[model samples]
Target: MVRQERAIRTRRAVVEAAAAVFAERGYTAATIAEILERAGVTKGALYFHFDSKEALARGVINAQISDDYWVPRELKLQEWVDIGMTLAHRIPKEVILLAGIRLSADIQGRSLFGSAWPAWTQLVTDKLVEAKARGEVLPHVTPRETAECFLGAWIGTQFMSEVVSDWTDLNDRISVLYNHVLPAIATPAALIRLDTAPDRGARVVEEVERQQRESPVPTEA
Candidate 1:
């Protein structure tokens, strides 16, 4: 049991190290030697935890998936949407690594979810479908398409923020998403509540800043 626990910790260390290094340097340029150094583990130890660098990269991506999305929150549609937007704020660094562009350059056997993206997307899509049925979404929009659009905008915004860190503030970006972007897709009834619909926006921003101070950077391995 002790050995199992230690192995879990070691694996986590490697993933967290990869996230930081990949975010810093990117996948194509990052190497096993660098990852091993960052992880403070020997190459043999890393191989013990993971079969190869490719497997380690998958671990990093898997860790992000485990961190990012969840269905058990059992939140209402708008609540789910808000949570999704809030978490989207954390995606840029993770996305770069997941795309195999920064840290997982050699990882190519499967997609991020390993045959489960559609399942996950369906879970989110279901919530949007419910929202639309309740007239929370605009009447003209289809639920699946609307969900895709919502995700696209969030991802695009995150990517742009990653590239032009100075041009965008995460807080301001989410506010714009809520006050401006959401209104475009929301029904008038939903739009009306934007003024006072429980400000998780502030909470999300505060959490990001808090994580920045406490963690200093991403750490998932």
Candidate 2:
């Protein structure tokens, strides 16, 4: 059990180090030596988890999205908004996510590891589908189209935020984005109830963590 836990930690460290390098330097420019040094792990350890740089890059790309189990909200749109807000709040602090987004956007890198956009679109579509079913979204809103368009805008917003403020104001920019976009998609009642505060992401993340902590752990009978 201990060995498994240590191996998990080591693999995570290697992935994080690689992500940091990829985020700072484009995928092609980054080197295994640098990742090794950054991770402070032996070459063997890295190779054990990932045989090549491509594999490491793929690992980071796959690891970027938050599969966090959030407590479901009464309003599905709120949960959908939380998805964006939490990402905006967390991305700046997470090099893995930053690297993944950068790598996914890199035109040159696209052939090697495809963009994460489709996966993200699907994720958003699923949530929006739920929201629509609940009548939280407008009748005219097509969940897939809305999700794709919103993702395109969100990607652009991320790029602009990173360039302008190195991501310091990402949450604020995302809040602004939600404010503009949600009004059109969400029902008037839903739109008025939704929270688009810049700090909303942080709060949402905290709520998830708090829920996790408070949730009862199952014990063997």
Candidate 3:
């Protein structure tokens, strides 16, 4: 059990190191040596988990969407809003998320490793579908199409923020985006009830963290 736990930690270290390097240098320029230095792990250890840089990049992309820290809302559309807002909050501070965003944007290395857009689109679509079933959205709203469009807007907004303010203003931009996008799809009742506050992501994250801090871990058997 100890050995398995160590392996898991080692793998996470390697993935996080690779994410940092990729976020800073892009995939083509990033090297295993830098990753090893960052991870404080051996070459053999990295190779054991990922045979090549492509594999490492794939691992980073895969790790982008995980058991994310979340706080659920009663409203499904609010839940959807929470998803975007949380991502907007984390992307600026989390190297893994930033690495995924950067890797997906780079056309040079994009074909070597596919982007996370499809997965994100699916996540958004699923939420929208739920919201629609709950009558939160307009009857004419299509979940998948709306998800795709929302993702496109999100990516564009992220890029613009990155260029303009190094993502210092991403939360506000994302909030603005939700406000504009929601009106078209959300029902009048839902729109009126939703919270698109720029600070929501931070609040949600804090609540989740507080829960984690208060939760008890299992005792050794």
For candidate 3, list the clashing residue pairs, or say none: none
Query: Could you give candidate 3's per-residue lDDT for residues 105-189 as a string of tens digits?
Result: 8888878888888899999899999999999999999999999999999999999999999999999999999999999999899
Best by lDDT: 3
Give the CA lDDT, 0 to 100, for residue 14 in model 2. 98
The residue-by-residue lDDT of candidate 1 on 1-221, one tens digit each, is 67787888888888877767666665556678888898898787789877865676667655654433332333245565555554544444354333433332233434431422343356557877777777777777676776666656655665566567832365456556656556667777776654323345445557556767887765443
The predicted structure with the larger TM-score, 1 or 3, is 3
- Model 1 worst lDDT window (10 residues): 96-105
The candidate that wins on TM-score is 3
| Model 1: colliding residue pairs | 12-221, 13-221, 16-221, 26-102, 27-102, 27-103
Cα RMSD (Å) between model 3 and the true structure?
1.5
Regarding lDDT, does 1 or 3 come out ahead? 3
- Supply the TM-score for candidate 2: 0.91
